[model samples]
Target: MAKNTVQFQQGFSLQEFISQYGSEGQCHQALFQWRWPDGFKCPKCGHVRYCSLKSRKLLQCNRRRSQISVTAGTIFDSTKLPLTTWFLAIYLVTQSKVSVSALSMKRTLGVSYNTALLMKHKIQQVIKERDDSKPIASYIIQLDGAYWGGKKRDGRRGRGTTGKLPFVAAVSTDDQGHPIEMRFSQVRAFSKDAIIEWATQHLCIGDEVVSDGLNCFNGLDEAGFDHRVIITGGGPESVKMAEFKWVNTIIGNVKRSLHGTFHAISKKHFSRYLAGFCYRFNRRFDLRQLLPRFSFVDLRTPPIPQRILKVAELCG
Candidate 1:
């Protein structure tokens, strides 16, 4: 008999993670591979030859003699933390079914709360950037909009709460009804224009989009997708409909995970947090691949200070 496998199920264990990436040398070697798969070419002069300056722990391009640290120009650039700590953080965030909180990370990594918080945000941002370039193509996408953190003292629900941030969720499932990919983003609001832009950016022609008959979703009219609007008329019965199975389940699980993990997340950085969930869920089939996947992205992604992450989100 075949047992059901949940999204978080994977073979990578804690002992395996520690054994594979326990030391600074191990992590450094991994980063070196991710950074230069073919061979080391100087970013400045493109020279293949390089020599390590042991005192400064730098790789100097033989031709230009430019010094490049292993962390140079990467997400870990200008960090005093060891590569092992960063690698452990990546493992913690990617492996957990429920997200890990900054405070919990502080305790786990033995770092200060502020440092843990910064590291968490940095990794989430990398996840966001990695998923940003992926769009739904040739698949039936379940579309829904959700509000987070809008619990009010008056016990009001759904739309127009001071604390709520609006986000749209989309999931692509296989013929057998298993989720394969997910796209989520925090938006200013659920309006026609907003949905139009989202559809254009994240959706493609062969993709069929299914959304609850929210009038705003009509924006997809010219989005070049075969779109269907199913209005369940707002009730448990409607939500139970098979048409919405994957999307509804995903939203429920994500909300629950967020609630269980963090004490509270502000609206500005909500998109990054959502990305963390989306990244994990979208790649759920092979959770063991997450560490290497994230390491590659971190190696490729541009560096940004903690200040820039907040400012960029706020400005957007």
Candidate 2:
């Protein structure tokens, strides 16, 4: 990594984003490059040769009579919104420290509330799917938890009971001892199995895991994890590990970003939102280009009936 923070800072402005990718066709081309870096291939026939329908922006397959659009088989498939709006939404969400709300995004992008909500959810899902494929394999992993969403009124913490949920996060340290890799999962119960499952999925075994004195981590020895518990009650000497500081800094950043930006987060969809937060936080350095480079691939297709049922279930 070349440590280019300029892109992240410059692209944070909405005016700059509109100036760069204002046209739907330009946004489509950028997505096309992201989907097929080498070239386009027919999803149906697996043939690379295709005629470009310049008028409709579609590719006519040479082997088959069918025509395919660049947005086919992606999240944008069948979407009525302009590609430029989607690009701007992705850029804005990824660049912001706190994830933007659908309401705010609707106002910002001049789209309907429902459209903004769907766009936010779809982009967040894409980021989650992409990041989930690349798990954090190595490095000093620091684990901690934080409770979000508390109201403050008249100089009090407001009973600290705003129905906020608890989230467990892990951050990896770089060679220079700075935090780099990050992962977060919403937790209902802080049990041993829950912690171990999350750790095994996102991290490799034998990686040095540091946490505070929590009984849930006591079983890591049996789970084949190199785990250590730091008793903060033992004064500064016990908390001497720099890795712990890095983890604390990550947690603090998440809290500040969430509190300052979104204001409040619902508990029902907390995990998905947490995943989006972690995605943005991890890529905070190169979000400008990376954010625009994301495309919705058909990695996993939800059955329409099942998706509808799940939505109904959640609504109920």
Candidate 3:
């Protein structure tokens, strides 16, 4: 079988994307390929051969009794919306730098707000699941914290802030000054325990870790990590690791995207939004493949609409 090939350019419009893989069948076929690269098999009977029921888009197990739809046992399971809408939502989320509002999604896809929110949450769950599986290690990682809040009041920054939350981020840097992996979280405090736990969970022991002077990260040496601290007081002269600058840039971009696009973010679901942002940030350079792969999930379902709209309203 020939490999599925997709080409995308920078500033590519959504209409072009829809034209490429616009149908539910096309999206389903890609999901089938991603789910089972080898071929279709019956999950129940462990049989390699199964008959495809084109009418229901299901694979019937010839050896045994139950019928399974293409979405069984995956994130797409139990969804009532069309697979094409999900695929489109995924594509939009991956392509956009900031979180896309469910209201916009509803208008774009012609679906109810509830359905859009549900689909967004489901996609976020899938992304979180995938991130949990792939741990970031064996690279130079930069650690930092940034605060996100609602719109600025009276042209003041970092003050008069309400509904703000703290986020800790770890970004793995490549030799070419590009980020290879990114992990983020919403936490109550940047305490020693919190920082250590976040580091241990996302990074391996041997990798080098760099951070700006934060007392919470003082004893990283005891944890088997080559930790370096850069003092922020002395401007660029106090900088020890240049990589932190890139990491800071990443954080700045994230904050700017959130503030400009969403306006305000709630603490309750900050991690989900962070995960979505991290996923997009790490894959920003690979929009061609990522966008197409993203376009393969179902987003018109009800759950996603609620989650997305609620988050958007909270942010606004």
Instruction: Please identify which of the two predictions, 1 or 2, would achieve the higher lDDT against the true structure.
Output: 1
Candidate 1, which segments miss by more than 4 Å at Cα?
Answer: 5-10, 151-156, 159-163, 310-316
| lDDT (Cα, tens digit) per residue for candidate 3, span 1-316 | 6542322436446887777668987877877776666887677877877787888888888888568777765556777778778778887777776878767888887888767766666677666555655667436888877667644666554423455676777888876766677887775666677777666667788888888777777756666789987676644444344767666777767777766666445566677788898777666657767754553333222223344435444432
Please report the candidate that would top lDDT against the real structure.
Answer: 1
The digit string of per-residue lDDT tens for model 1 on 1-316 reads 5565853365689899989899877888788888899989888888899998878768998887889998887778888898888888888889887788887888999987777777888888889888887685435788898888775568865544565798998988777766778888888788888988888778886777888988888888766678898888987787677878888898888888887777667776889888888888777778889999898888888886667565333311
Q: What is the lDDT of candidate 1?
A: 0.81
Better of 1 and 3 by lDDT: 1
* C-alpha lDDT of candidate 2 relative to the true structure: 0.69
Better of 1 and 2 by TM-score: 1
* lDDT agreement with native, every candidate: 0.81, 0.69, 0.68
Q: After superposition, how far is residue 19 of candidate 2 from its true place, in Å?
A: 4.6
